[model samples]
Target: MLTVLMLGDSLVEWGDWPSLLPEVAVINRGIAGEMTEELSARLMDEIDACPDPDAVLIQSGTNNLLFGYILFPTMLITMLQRLRLCYPSVPLIVNSLMPMPIVAPHDLEQINRELAVAAAATENCHFLDTVGPFQEQCLPITHPGFLNDQVHLSTRGYQVWAATIKGLLEQLFPGKLPG
Candidate 1:
């Protein structure tokens, strides 16, 4: 079975990916209220433990923005570089920051753009633009019952997220999942 390591903050911590992608084994290393710097510090050890993941999924930086840090792009890039150093060949899927009710759409858009560009520029890395789909459910004006709170996803949200990433995973590593 394919093993995917997911690392991030509360959004990732609350997800139940094993249930969502039954074909693959998911190792979640998410910690609630974790900032980018903290995640960076723990990343090398986490990757060392996994050592051979088919892919790594990350969705951090929200807390950095929430805590009033202006260095999100730099921090995120550093984290990606660290991951690359640890697992040079493993595919890294960088999911865009989910839309939050409190953060301005324009500001969030900028951060997502920065992350997308960085991921695209990195070797063996790809950006998963989840903002639009998530906005369809999480945005206050377009809420479709996917998010429990303004920040965290509900069960339905996790389902959506899983489906979205599954498609990309299949594309990136076709036939890796067994029946």
Candidate 2:
């Protein structure tokens, strides 16, 4: 079975990944209110627990936006680097921060852009844009797919996320995971 480590903040913590991707062995290492520093602190232990993950999917930074953190880009790069150090050969999918109505659209775009560049610079890392499908054109506001709160995801939102990841997995590993 393909073993994947899903890591991040609440976006990762709140998902029912086992049910969403029943075909693979998914280890959810998401914490509800984690920032990059907390993630960095616990990352080694999380990876050590699953010594040989086939891939790692990461989605974070929303909390940073929520709390008005300024060093997002640097911390994000650090987070990606740490993951590479632990699993150099493993595919690391660094998901873009989801759109948040509370944060300005331009700010979110900037963060996502920087994240894309950072992910590209790292070996074995892929930046997955989880924003475009969920938000309107160039707007920070989410479409109707999000939960009523407009921050967290709804069931349909999760389904959309799973389908997107599933497609990428199919493309990346071909027959390794069941449809």
Candidate 3:
């Protein structure tokens, strides 16, 4: 099974990754309410714990937004640089901030734009933009993607996220991952 090291905040921590991606070995290093700066600070330790992962996926910055740090990509870019140094040949997947009721759409768009740019500039890095997929999947009022807190994801939301990850992994690894 392909091993993926996932790092970030609650989104990564709370996910039932083993069940979500049954075919892969997921090493989740997520801390709830963690900010970009905090993640950067402990990033090395996290990577050290999982010395030889096939890939790394990061989904941070939402907590930073809650703390009113709009331009989080600056710190995120720095963190990505460090990650590249640690895992030069491994594929790095950077997840865009999901659209939430708390953040304005424009601000989310701007943040995702910067994230996309950062991923594009990094070698072997891939960007996963979830805004459109989430929006499309949660169109029905009864099937809202977010939990009651309007920040965390609901089951439907996770399905969308998992599907997206699976698709990307398939592309990155070809037939290595089960369909």
Which predicted model would earn the best lDDT? Answer: 3
Candidate 2: what lDDT?
Answer: 0.80
TM-score for each of the candidates: 0.90, 0.90, 0.97
Worst 10 residues of 3 by lDDT: 136-145
**CA shift of 129, model 1, Å:** 0.8
Candidate 3: count of backbone clashes, pairs at least 3 residues apart or interchain: 0
Best candidate (score: TM-score):
3
- The models' CA-based lDDT, in order, is 0.82, 0.80, 0.91
How many clashing pairs per prediction, in order? 0, 0, 0
For residue 46, model 3's alpha carbon misses the true position, in angstroms, by 0.9
| Per-candidate RMSD, Å | 2.1, 2.7, 0.9
lDDT of 1 by residue, 1-179 (tens): 88889999988888877788898888988999998888988988897799889899998988887777847778778888888988899999998887776778888888888999889878999999887777564544454424545677766667778878888988998888654
lDDT of 3 by residue, 147-179 (tens): 988899988888899889988999999989975
How do these models rank on lDDT, best leading? 3, 1, 2
Candidate 3 ranges beyond 4 A from true positions: none
State how far residue 48 of model 3 sits from its true place (Å): 0.8
**Candidate 2 lDDT, tens digit per residue, 1-179?**
88889988887888898888888787888899888777877878888898898899988777887788857768878878888888889999988887766668988888889888988999988888877666533333443556667678777677767777877777778888865
